[model samples]
Target: MKASEIRELKDEEIVHEVRRLRRELYTLRSQAVTEKLENPRQFGVIRKDIARLLTEQTARRNQAKTAGAAE
Candidate 1:
């Protein structure tokens, strides 16, 4: 997933997407163990996506917290 796409997602959607990606990562790991993986690079790509989502999620949460505190 691209950073621009991630930025466009709602907060709830970000959480949902992260959960879905985690499941995919788990399955990919299982496939790798069984030597069934077609593209090993997918693992890195998914991990990066997960990180990006988490980063955005955290930033939003922090922004909200500061906004609430300032009010």
Candidate 2:
């Protein structure tokens, strides 16, 4: 998923999306080990997307914390 698409999601949706991506990564790894994965590159893409989502979430949280502290 693109970062723009991820940004469009609400916080709750992003949380769910992260969980779903992790599950997909797990499943892809299992398939790869079994020599059944049709597209192993999907694993790399999913991992990157998860990282992007987590980074965005963390930045948002930190921003909120800083704003709260300044109030």
Q: Stretches of candidate 2 above 4 Å error?
A: none
- Expressed as tens digits, the lDDT of each residue in 1-71 for candidate 1 is 89899999999999999999999999999988988789999999999999999999999999999999999
How do the residues 6-51 of candidate 2 rate in per-residue lDDT, one tens digit apiece? 8888899989999999999998888888877787789889999999
Instruction: Give the lDDT of residue 59 in candidate 1.
Output: 92
lDDT of 1 at 32: 89
Best candidate according to lDDT: 1
- Candidate No. with top TM-score: 1
* Residue 62, candidate 1: C-alpha displacement in angstroms: 0.4
Q: Give RMSD (Å) of candidate 1 vs. truth.
A: 0.8
Clashes of each: 0, 0
